[model samples]
Target: METSTASPPANGRVHHPGLRTLVQTTRFHAEHRPDTAAVICEGRTLTYDALHRGSNRVAHALRAAGLGEGDRVAYLGKESEHYYEILFGCAKSGTVLVPVNWRLTAPEVSHILQDSGTRLLFLEDEFTQVVEGMPTAPPETVVRLSAFGTWRAEHADSEAEFEATSDTPVAQLYTSGTTGLPKGVVLAHRSFFAIRDALASEGLDWIDWRAGDIALIGIPGFHVGGLWWATQNFNAGTTVVAMRAFAARRAVDLIRDLGITTACVVPAMLRMMLTEPGVSAEDFTTLRKTVYGGSPIAEALLEESLAVLECEFAQIYGLTETGNTAVCLPPAAHVPGGPLMQAAGHPYPGVRSKVIDEQGRELPPGAVGEVCLHTPARMVEYWGLPDKTAETLVDGWIHTGDAGYVDEDGYVFIRDRIKDAVLVAGENVYPAEIENVLEAHPGVAEAVVVGAPDERWGEYVHAFVVPVSGHEPSPRDLHTFLVPRLAAFKLPARYEFIDRVPRNPSGKILRRELRDRFWNDSARKVN
Candidate 1:
C-alpha cells in the first residue's frame, strides 16, 4: 500500500496542555476569556462565561431528569447558540450528544431516535409536529428550543461534579445512509482536539485559528465538518458566528458586516454565494481564509472563487469517521492550473494514509485503489453495529471506500466513491471524471453522472446536467465539447436537463436518489 506519514517538528510543544477534553477546554476558556463572545447567532451573543454557566445548568437538568453517563440526548434543531450550550453541557455531564439533521423526514428522524435510544429530545417549535407524527413513539422527554431558556433556568448554574476523560464519548453523529438506515458514528472528546494537538509545534497554517478571528460556521452543526470547525475555533478562544440556515445573500452580509475572517463551507455553498446577486469582492475583504470540502470542486468554480473572494482557500477531505479532516489541501497549493490543484492535499501531521488494491495489497504511487486513513481523531465505533465497525475500522485504519491514489510527494487524489464507478464494457469509469468535465462547460452550471443499465455495455453513463442560467447546451453540443477531452468510453451516453441537482443538508450530491429511478425494476443494480 502506498503510505504517507509526517514526522512531528523537532521543537514541537503542546499548545494547550490543559485543554485535553471538551469539558476542560470550555472551562479553561471561561476562566481565561470569560467576557469574549463564544458564539453569535441571530442577534444573540453567548459569552464564554455565560456558555459555561448555561451548559452547567443543562448538565444539572440532564442529571435531574435521571440521565447518566453514556445516555443519548438528541438535539433536533437548526444552528443556534443554545445548541452549543447543550453540546458542552453533554460534554460536561457525560451524556452523548446526538445532533439530528432537521431536514430529515419523520421516519428517518424516528429511526435515529430509536437507534440511539434517545431518552430526551431537544427540537425547534416548527418540528414539533414532525416528531409527533413519527411512526414510532418519540423520545419520552421533549424540550422545545422556544422554551429552552425557561427550562434551563430551572436548574442551577453550578459546575457538575461529574467528570469525563478525553476518551469519553461526547457526540454521536449519524451518516447519510444512501442505501439503508444511517449509522451513528460515536466520537470521543479527543476527536475534537487530536489534529490540533499534533500540529501545535508544526506551525503550519493549513487550518489555523487565532484570537479576535470571527469564524463563520456555514455548514450546519449536524454535519461533522460544521461540528469540528466550530470546536476548533472555540478551542482557540475565537468568536464563532453561526447561521440558523445557510442563505447565500445572508452569508455575504455576515462576512461584510460581522467582519468574518475565517469560514468553513462546502463547494456548492461557495458557488451559490459567488452567483448571488449584488455580491462583489468588497463583501469578502475581511475573509482571510476559507476551508471547503464535502465534494470535489469544479476547476471553473475554484477559479471564480479565487478571483472573487480574493482570499486563501484550503480544501479538506475526510469522513465523519475521521473526525471531519485528516487531509488538507493548503491555501498555497490552490493554483488554478497547477498539477496539485486536483489533489486532495497531504495528510495532516499525526495522520497516516495508504492506498490498497482489490486484493488488499498495497498499491504503488499513482495506482488507483481504495484510500484508507489512520488518524488519532478517528471515531470510536459505529454505535451498536459491531459487524459494520469491524468491516470499516480494520487494524486501526478507516477504509475510506474512495477510489484514489497517493502521489510520490504524498499528495492524494480522489476520483470518486468506488461503488459509484460505472462499468462500461468492463472498463471502470468514475462519475466524478465525467461530472468534472461537464461542470467545466460554460453552459453547464452543475452535473451528476450515474450508471444506467444497458443491454450492450452492461451499464452506460447517464448525466443529469443543471444548465447555467439563460444557457442551454444541447446533447450534440455537450458531446462535441467532451469528445476531445474524455475517452470515448468515458463520455456521457445520455443527458437530462434539470434546474437544480438534489443534495443532502451537507451539500453532497445524492446520486443514489437519481440512480435508483433507473434501477428500480432492474434484476441487478450492476452488471
Candidate 2:
C-alpha cells in the first residue's frame, strides 16, 4: 500500500535524509537495486548502478565546465535515455536543464537558446545547422551528443560538491507558443513529483506501478509530460523503455514484444498505432495502464482502444506550467453512459481547480469561464517574462487560456482555447467542438477548425481535414455529415483538404499555422 508517513530509506548513503529531490530518488534506486534495468533505449540498456555512476560523471563534467547552481544548460536532441543522465546530474549539481524542441526552426531554436541565456548546450549532431544559421554566435560551450562520452571521461565519476533542495528550479521547458512567441517555463523539482507524493499520501497508485512495471515513453523530450513521465517511473525504480522517435509500427511491435506495463501517450499516437498492420488485441496483453492527454480523444477512438487494449485509461489534463497532470479521468470513471469522458475529471490530490470570469472572480459550477488551477506542481515562473508571468499566474492560480466550466462534482469540461474561439456573427464557436464533429465522419482521419477572414460574418469557420486511406472526403461530404451534428453557425463555411494536421512536438494541433495561410494578405491578422 502507498505509505507517506515516513521516508522510504535508501540502500546506501542518504542523499537528502528523506525523499526530497530528484537526485535523492535516483540515488535510492541506484543503491537499492544496483543491477536492475533503469532505462532501455535503441540497443542500449542502463542499469541503476550504471546510470548513477554515469550521472555522477556528468555532474563532475558540468562542474568542470563551470556550471553550478542556477546556471542554465540547454539540450537539443530527440528523445534518448541519455537525457535521464543529464537531467539527474543537473538535479544533483543544482543546474537548470533546458530541453529545446529540435523540431523547431533555426530561428525558433535560436530564440530559445538566447532567451534562456544558457552557458552551455548539448546539441545532437544533426541539429548543428540550428546554431550555424543563428544571426549571432552560438553559446561558448557546445558538446555534440556523439562525442558526449569524451566530454564525460574528462572528469571522474564523483558526486558534485553542490546539493539541490526540493524547491530548486530544475527544468526550463519552453511552451509551443501557438498564439505568439514561446516562453520558458521554470519548474522546480518538487513541482515535478507533487502528484506522486500526494498519491503516496492517499494510499493510492494513480497508474498502479507495481514491482515489475515497465513503461514506454513516446512523447518528445521538449515537453514536461515526456520528462515528467520518465522521472515518475524512475522515482519508483521501474524500468523505462525509451524511444528516439515514435513510429506507429515500431510502437506496435514494441508493445507486443517489450512487456510495456504502463505507457504515457497522446491521443494521436493511439490512433496511429491502430493503423499499423498485424496489430490486434493480443499485442497489448501486457499493458495494464495508459495515460493519454495533449488533446482530447474522440469517443470512437477511445472506445476502439478500450475494446482492443483492455487496459486502464487515465485521461489527464494539464499544461506545461502545471508541471504535468493536475486532473485525471481514471479507468473506473470511464463508463458507457457516464460524465467522465466529457469532463477532465476532478483535480488530483493537492490540486484545486476552478472556473473564473474576466475579473478573476470565481464562477458558479455551470458557468463557462477560464479554467484555473492551483497546484503544488505549478511552475515557478515563465523565465525572463515577468510581465507575462504575472498576467498568467495570479495569486498561485494559473489562469489557463482554456474556456471551460467546472461541474458540481468538480469535473472540468474543456471546450476549446479561449484564444482559438471564433466569433462568427457574434456567436462563440470552439474549434475543438467542430473538429470533434468532423472527426466523427467515417472517411475523415483528422480534422481541425480555424476561423478565416470574412467580409459579412466578421469571421467564418474553416475546416482543414485529412482523409483516411483510400478515401477523399469532399467539402460537401463533410458538410453533409456535420450538418446534423453541429449548429448552423458552427458548421464549416469552407473546407480544405490537407495532408495531415500539423502538430507540435507535444501533439497539440498548430491551428495558427493552418489559419495563417488563409489570412496571409488579409486586412486584419486575427479573424
State every prediction's TM-score relative to the real structure: 0.96, 0.94
Error of 1 at 386 (Å): 0.3
Candidate 1 structure quality by residue, lDDT tens digits, 1-527: 11212223452222454577878767877887899999999988999999999999999999999999999999999999999999999998899999999999999999999999999999899898889889999888999999999999999999888888878999999998887889999999989999887666567778777657899999999999999999998887889999999999999999999999999999999999999989999999999899999999998899899999999999999999998899999999999899988889999988999999988899999999999999999999999999999999999999999999999999899999999999999999999989988999999999999999999999999999999888999999999999999999999999999889989999999999999998999878897
Which lDDT tens digits does candidate 2 get at residues 1-527? 12123324431111122566777776777777889999999868999998888888888898888888999999999877788889888887889999999888888888898999999999999999877897777888999999988888887776666767778999999999887789999999887678877766665545545667789998887888888889887877789998998888888788788888889999999998987787899999999899999887777788878888998988889998988888888788877556676677778878999898888889999888899999999989999899999988999999889999998888898988887889899998988888877887889889899998888998999888898888888888888888788899999998888899999878888888988887889877765
Question: Candidate 1, which segments miss by more than 4 Å at Cα?
Answer: 1-15
Report per-prediction Cα RMSD to one decimal.
4.2, 3.4
lDDT (CA) for every model shown? 0.91, 0.84
Question: In candidate 1, how many Å is residue 489 off?
Answer: 1.2
Specify the highest-TM-score model's number.
1
Cα lDDT for residue 325, model 2?
88
lDDT of 2 at 387: 96
Which parts of model 2 are misplaced by more than 4 Å? 1-17, 522-527
Candidate 2: count the clashes: 0
